[model samples]
Target: MSATVSPDQLPLQRLYHWERTAPNRVAFTQPVGGGQTVDYTWKQVVDQARRMAAHLQAQGIGAGDKVAMLSKNTAHWMMTDYAIWMAGAISVPLYPTLAAGTIRQILEHSEAKLLFVGKLDGWLGMKPGIPEGLPCIHHPLAEADAKKSYPGWDDIVAKTAPLAGEPVRPADDLSTIMYTSGTTGAPKGVMHTFANFMAAVAAGLERIPQNEGSRMLSYLPLSHVVERALVEHGQLQTGMHVYFAESLDTFTTDMQRARPTVFFSVPRLWVKFQQAVNHKMPQKKLDTFLKIPILSGIVKKKILSTLGLDQCIFAAGGAAPMPAELLAWYSKLGLNIAEGYGMTENIGASHITTGDPDSFGTVGRPYAPVQCRIAPDNGEIQVKAPWNMLGYYKQPELSAEMFTDDGWLKTGDKGSTDAQGRLKITGRVKDLFKTSKGKYVAPAPIEDKLVMHNAVEACCVTGANLGQPLALLMINAEATAVVKNGGKAELEASLAEHLKHINETLDPHEQLDCLVITSEAWTVDNDLITPTFKVKRNRIEDMFAKNYDRWVGMRKPVVWHG
Candidate 1:
């Protein structure tokens, strides 16, 4: 990392740089359906943001005021965030899929002065959470009813004069309050300064190396810390051309259009991509093709092209543990997926894999100037970084608990460092469960192995007081459809074989009692998984703990649950 970073490298400062240096360069490309797209030049992006900043200031949103954003990733979503900062306000972003109660909790807790609504699929369900009389500005991509109800972005920009001159914010000023997509409990607002954001991006760029010619596709929820730091701040730093996905149905088209030089996604999406490829070309057939010397290169190229990652120079997976098997699979296909480790607390800069075969399963060395260690007492991973959060907003007691007597942030993840200083996370301290036999098992590792099977989408391994742990598996949509069509016998036989293979690798106590194939899907709507696709263990317990004994006592290797 650079020893001294100029204040000029701050997000707003970088935006100003691009606006002046390359006013005509395309900054954002937005899909508008029907095979059409709209491009926003740097000048256009800055102009709209400037006018919106003036509008926000006119409404008394200045000097640390909190402005909330509720939307999916869109060009205007980034624009609105810039506008909030220009108004001397702290931006608070909400995940677009948040339920009404959680939505209301965050808005009321942050005491947001205003809200920006954009590109939401569930506005009607989420609208009840917004307190009446709170001012809102709608992005053009917002829901139809929301557009009719709130002041539109174009309308406000048209009426307001652009703020003149280069208004500067101090480096230490609060920039954004990112609420965690809580997997266990209520969301906590993670506060970050402008300098924190800049430091994280700088450390990242020191290794990843993006420039003006870099292209990125923004589809991950920008509300997440990884996306906020990598895509939004990365673009601001390097003048990357960002493309937005119009919808899930058109994601492939959007990816082909962007041909992003840099791409990041969670493990679930990576698994889905592999599943899609296997659906088209069975893994057995693909493997056989790759063994032929002449056809190997051609086969790899065709597969990457089909997945729209043929031009991707850097691809990463984070926000959860990526299965080593999955990484090896992509490695064979000529795409090396770097696994990164970070949390909302660290501004998503801690460690990343170095693309070394020796560092395959470990998150490679920590970024420069970031210190990482395992706690002597509980084995929790603790980190001290320039970009660590100020603390959880307005929760002084909880914030105090998040750190040690010194300043290291307690990451809650149990991990160890290798001889080369790479990190290998074992499990969450709180995620370990002791069974009736008094042997504690970390479910994440076992669940990682189970999810490698094609039929499983998401899973949870839990027992608590039972004799042994058991797994609750949610078969993926395609497999579920096949089961509904009466292919249960074959699916059951396949899962039983997979279960036997997995258990053979484990000690008797650590082996699962049974694999219960769940009837219901685990989704955000059902409160069984976070928006980032991490399974909620507590929710899984609430829904299935009552049946643990029955599941284990069934005396079958695989049990089908209704």
Candidate 2:
């Protein structure tokens, strides 16, 4: 059965519902230094948002004005979004890790009336992007130095009168303009309405186990569509308790504090967790212990407790394709991570696995109310749903191009559907590269295999116009530590063996020629990866395509690139 949405289910309506019925319920838990934390109740959240909304109105922010937020996920981030909506303005969220040039482009293109700068790692680098004379407010958690440079959040809230009465927006009113984390080209602003977000949340709640008091950890950048919809909108719709992670260094500590019942993460972090576990105990030894029925239960409980996922009733992985091997590994550890598929255009609500063992490789069936199909000509996956974005902001022509003549959103991913309607994404339509032998190769599947080894952190498979494809690999922390301790040769041998094993399973044309260990790291700062840790294939081509032939010519299974 398809999911249905009602006007009462709107985000603001839900916020009002909780404020009246569950005023004392803890809405957010924010970690401070020295193992300290701060909590906000439903009434407190609404009260502060009301004050901020009045302040915004006083500043001339009216209906449809774009108010952008530049910060990591925090309680104030949520409060700021509510304030923007309450003031009848559309919210624009920028990824905290964006480059200054990109930030300027979005702010300029969005015509944002104001920017709210909150928690950030590189505020100094991002500060220059805000246009001069542009009104700005620094959140309570903004960097100490940056906090002094702008109007503080607390001061404004303290002095301003709370906006009287509940200021409601229409369900059709535009809620947010989410900029895509560009992997192929320049980012596009995806426009979503309040109704659209509510519909997506309605569909999600139909399947995912979430309700009032369901705990969630909001560490993924809320700028992303999935995190915003699932973590923010999910919390509103269900009155769930949301917790914020302080920093990367305190991620484990933060997880323990929240002990979230609902968790979502990308493929990279899942692999890292696996690596961390293997680093402590060899996988083979763990497998041996798992064979003992009595010991297996004890072992799994201990592992889950250590990772703070002991209470995780529903764990999901998205933003990128998850390795099937990784899924099996987590399943073996008693944590069934349901892999889902979606994008910024869909509010990141589309398909998700439902714990079917046979659905391991596929992303599973479309959510209730989401219709999916494969295009006959290109095999690109297409979807139609109530939650689909209204259109791209201000880019009418491009927005029109994103849909089919029949109105389905073109996902640009090539995949086949199983008999039961599950989707198995083969690769992106634009990510395919033709070799000198004229056979086109898809890199995502091969790249997934390469990351299964604990030594490899991130890798890209590309060798367009070359006889065979080759991979650019960046070793993980453990491998780097090992190499620094005069174990480079041992690591090289291990990589060579891993490379050969992967190549043997591929078709002749799809087989990789060699694995090049890159000296430079692929990072968000380098424009080599998106904030979500998905590699930018176009950027990879620009940076390393010239070295493909040279590495292949070395005639070794593994080649170190300086």
Clashing pairs in 1: none
lDDT of 2 at 8: 84
Q: Estimate candidate 2's alpha-carbon lDDT, on a 0 to 1 scale.
A: 0.92
How does candidate 1 score on lDDT? Answer: 0.91
Residues 1-562 of candidate 2: C-alpha lDDT, one tens digit per residue = 2224687888888888999999999999998678889999999999999999999999999998999999999999999999999999999999999999999999999999999999999899988898998999999989987788899999999999999877788888899999998797888999999988888988888889999969999999999998999999999999999999999899998999899999999999999999999999899999999999999999999999999999999999999999999999999989999988999998888899985567899999999788999999999999998878888998999999989998999998999999888999999998999999999999999999999999999999998899999999999988999999999999999888998899899999999889999889889999999999999988988988887877888899889888
* Candidate 1 weakest lDDT stretch, 10 residues: 1-10
Angstrom error of the Cα, residue 511, model 2: value is 0.8
lDDT of 1 by residue, 103-143 (tens): 99999999999999999987999999998888888999899
- Work out how many backbone clashes candidate 1 has: 0
After superposing candidate 2, which stretches have Cα over 4 Å from the reference?
1-4
* TM-score between candidate 2 and the true structure: 0.99
